[model samples]
Target: MSVLLPPYAEALGVVAERDDNGRLVLAMDFAAHVRGRPGFLHGGAIAGLLELAAIATVQDRLGSDDRPRFKPITVTTDFMRGGRDKRTYAAAVISRLGSRLANVESFAWQESEDTPIAAARLNFLLARATGSPNR
Candidate 1:
């Protein structure tokens, strides 16, 4: 199954792929459209990547379009360093999934995963899909 990212993610050229561990990883190539300052990726773009990664993680977990819906309740992003003009990667993990809420943490990095360019925490409100078997 694949996660259906929004149009904004398409505009950002976000690509989803499986890492060596068979985990979801989101990637974006740096372009003029995604540049902010002289040579750095736009802050908005980084935040967008984080957000999309989170949504993708949740959607991939649910595994189907007919699964429950998750709506972002709050998002907090931290910028650690400027993203250079290169391919950037992001990965997210669900910290907690509950009947009514979910917490996800995403990190964006370039060159090294240990050194993150940015990170984000997202809270989502979960709504059960009508007549769905999976919770």
Candidate 2:
């Protein structure tokens, strides 16, 4: 499906790219626009980026003409370290796929391969392909 990102996400410098395994990779470069405490990235901004990445992964897997509207059922985020002024990557994995709901877990990391900056667990209620809300 043709998914057009929101203007706000675009303006924040979030870029959605695909990896070799077809996983959706959402990335953003640190700038003054998203600073939380001086040089650190904002928590909300990270959460937003993670959520966007998770939603996009679900969409990419669901296929064309299928809109997956995710309501943040519950998200527990752990800030492993301060997100520095560098490009950050967010990756999502579908943990459980059901007919009504899907559970996803995502991780955020800086360029360093040795450490993860943050991680999050997202529970999303997946609507039917016809756009029917889960009951």
Candidate 3:
């Protein structure tokens, strides 16, 4: 299935691909627009990537038939390290998915998966698709 990302994500040069484990991996290329300080990535850009990854993960889980509507409740982000000038990758996992809510966690890393530059925990309120029996 094709994954649809927002306009902002496209502006940031973010692209989606499947990892070895067959999970969605979102990548953002470092550029002047995403730069901060001398050569580090902007925190906001990193957070945005995490947020998008989280939403995509939830959407993947819900599938096309369900077509669930998502309302973001909150996102807690932790900056683990300074993101250097390079391509950064993020992947999210659904911690919990229920009829009314979803909990997701995403992490961004550059050189190594063991070393993450940032991480975020996201909570979303899910509304069942209109005309769906569950709705």
Candidate of highest TM-score? 3
In model 1, what is the error at residue 126, expressed in angstroms?
A: 1.8
lDDT of 2 by residue, 1-135 (tens): 555566767877888887797667889999988789988999988887887777887777887766666667889888899999899999888998765677888888897636888888889877665756665
Mind giving the per-residue lDDT tens digits that candidate 3 earns over 10-113?
98889998998889999999999998887999999999999989988788777776667777888999999999989999999899998888999999999999
Ranked by TM-score, top first: 3, 1, 2
TM-score of each model, in listed order? 0.90, 0.87, 0.92
Top-lDDT candidate index:
1
Residue pairs with colliding backbones in model 2 are none
RMSD score of candidate 2 (Å): 2.1
Runs of candidate 3 exceeding 4 Å displacement: 129-135
**Model 1 per-residue lDDT tens digits across residues 29-102:** 99999999989999999999999999888888877854567678899999999999999999998999776778
Q: Rate the local accuracy (lDDT) of all candidates.
A: 0.90, 0.81, 0.89
